[model samples]
Target: MQSKKIAIIGAGVMGKKHAQTIVKHPDTELVAICDPFSDAMAQEFNVPNYKDLDDLLNTMTLDGVVIANPNRFHVSTAIQCMQHGVTCLLEKPLALNTAEALTLIEAQQSLNVPILVGHHRRHNKIIQQAKEIIDAGTLGEINTFNALWSVYKPDSYFDIEWHRVAGAGVLAINLVHDLDLMRYLNGEIESVQAMTSNKNRKLEVEDSISILVRFKNGALGTLLASDAAVSPWGWDQNTEENKTSFAVSPDQDCYFISGFEGALSVPNLEYWNYPKDQSKSWSTSLMKNKVEPNKEEDVYIRQLTHFVDVMNGIAEPISSPQDAIHNIQLLECIELAAKEQRTVYLEQLQCFKKSA
Candidate 1:
C-alpha cells in the first residue's frame, strides 16, 4: 500500500513530537503542520506549515490529522477534520468537558470516519498484556484499584494564561488518565465523593484533590493528586516555601489492580497468577509471573498508525469518541463530587458548557 499522509494540528511540543514520528515511521509521511503561531520553530521541522486549519484543509490531501491543540480547541479542530473526511487522532481529555466531547462524538460517528483519542497509556504493551490476563480470568473478580498520581508542579505551569479554566486542574490534566484507566480496567464508576483544596498554591483551582469511587461491580477506587507535594517531578511543590525537599524516586506514579484471586502491579506488570487449587486460598502461594513491561514505545506513532488502519478498514480503533464522552462524564462527576462534597452518580453527571 502507498504511504499514508498525515496533517498535524498545533505546532507546540506535542505537535512537533508527532511530526517527528510521522516522518520517521515508514508507514506514514508528514505532509503538513497547522499552527497559528509564527515561531521560527515551525520552519525548523522542514514540513509545510499553515497559519490555520482551513488553509491546511483547503490545500492538503491528508489521510489523517493528529490534534495536539489546547484543551479548549480540540472539539472544533476535530469536527473540522472529520467533516473534511479525514480520520482524527485527538489528544487526551478529549475536550474541556463532556458536552463538547459529545458533540464531536456525534459528528465523527455520522461522518463514517474513525476518531481515535490519545489515551496513550492504553497502548502500552504491559497494559495490553495485563488486560489480556484479566480478561482470561487469571485474576478473578477484580475488587479494587489504587491509583496515586503525585508530582511537583512547575511555578510557571500555574502561571500559564489558560490555567484559569475550570477543566485545567489536576482532575482534567492528571487524574483523567487514572480515571480512564480505572474505567478501562474495571467498569463504569457508579458513584463518587470527592474533596479539593487550594491550600498554599496561588492558583484559581484546587491544588490537591481526593476522589472516592464506587464502581458498578462494587470495586473501590481512590484517585488522588496534589500539586502541593514536594516531589521534584511535575507537581506544584516548591522547596523555598516549606524548606523541605522531596526526591523523585523509583515508585512515583505506580498503580496496582487487585482482584479476589490476585493482583497486578505497574512498571513490573507482575501478575499474581493465583494457583489453580480451589480448596486452599491462593493468597499465600500466589505465584508471580513477570511479563515484559511495555517500554516507552512512541505511543503517538502507534495511535496514528491505528487511526490510519481503521480508515483503511484494516483495524478497529480501541479508543472511540464514545469512550471519550464516557470519560468526560466521569470527569464531570469528579469535579461536581469534589465541589459539593457529596456522592455523585455516573448518570447524575451534569453536562458542562463552555464559559462565556
Candidate 2:
C-alpha cells in the first residue's frame, strides 16, 4: 500500500509523539506540522509548519490529519477537516463538553469518510486479550469492575493557565481514558453518579473524582481518579506501555473485575476460577491462572495503521465519531452528577433525546 500523507495539528507532547510515529509507520507519511507555535518540530521534521488550518489546506491535499490541539478546538477543527473531505484522528475528550461533541457527532452523519477517535488504549493487544477472555465465558457473566487511576502531579504541573480551568481537570484528562476502557472492556454505561473535589489542591478544577457506574447489561462499576494521590494504580503507573509516564515497580494492578465464574485483574491478566472437580462454594479453593497477550506492534502505531485502513476503506474505526461523542457525554453526565449531587442517566441527556 502507498503511504498516506498526514499532518500533526498540535506541537505539544501528543502531537510530537503522533508526528514521530506517523513518519515511521509503513502506511503513513508526515506531511507537515500545523500549530501556531510550531517552527521547532517543522524544522526538526523538515516539513512546512502552518499557523492555521486554511494555510495548510491550501498548500496540499492530505490523506488524513491528527487533531492533537486543545480541548476547545477539537470539534471545530474536526468539522473543518471533515467538511474539506479530509479524514481525522481526533484525540480524546472529543469536545469541550457533551453539547459541542454532540454537534460534531451530528455533523459527521453527513459524511461517509471515517473519523477515528484517539482512544489509544483500545488498540492495545493486552486489552484485546482481556476482551477475548471475558467474551469466552471464562469469566462467566461478568458484572462488576473496580477501576482506579491515582497518581501525583507536581505543583509546577499546574503552572499552565488552562490546567487550572473547569475543562482541564482529572475528570477530563485521566477519567476519560478509564471511562472508555471500561466501556470497551465491559459495556455501555447506562447511568452515572459522581462526586469530585479540589480538596487536595486549591484550584479551579478538580484534583480527584469518584464515580458509580451502571451498565446497560446490569453490570456495575466504580471509576476513581486522583492526581493528588501519592501512590500508584492507574495504567500509567501499572504498565510500561508509555515509557514517558511513570511505571510502578513489581507492577501493581489497577483493575479488579469479578464475574459469576471467577475474578480477574487487568494488565496483569490474572484469572481466578473455581476448581473443576470441586463443588463451588465459599469453602472451595479457587485456582489461579494467567493470560498472555499475542505479540503486536505498538498501540499508537497500530492506531495509525488502523486510521490508514479507515481512510482507505479497508476497515471501520475502532472508536467511531459516535463512540467518541458518547464518551464525552459520559464525562459530561459525571460532572453534572457531581455538581448536582444526583444520579444522571444516559438516556435523559439532550444528546440521547435527539438520537431517540
Tell me each candidate's TM-score: 0.87, 0.95
List per-prediction Cα lDDT, in the order shown: 0.74, 0.86
* Most lDDT-accurate candidate: 2
- Overlapping backbone residue pairs in candidate 2 total 0
**Stretches of model 2 off by over 4 angstroms after superposition:** 293-296
Candidate 2, run of 10 with poorest lDDT: 242-251
For residues 33-110, could you state the per-residue lDDT of candidate 2 as single tens digits?
Answer: 899965898899999999989889878899999999987799899988888899999988678776787788788887
Residue-by-residue lDDT tens digits, candidate 1, 1-356: 88888888888877887888788888898887788876454577677788878889989888888899887899989998888998888887687767777778778768887888888767655567778878887768988787766766778876777675565678877777778878887887788889987876756777888888999899998777786675433211211111234443433225678887778876456778656764446345678887765555655567666777886888877887777677888778878787777888876545532210
In candidate 2 the C-alpha lDDT for residue 144 amounts to 92
Every candidate's CA RMSD: 5.2, 1.8
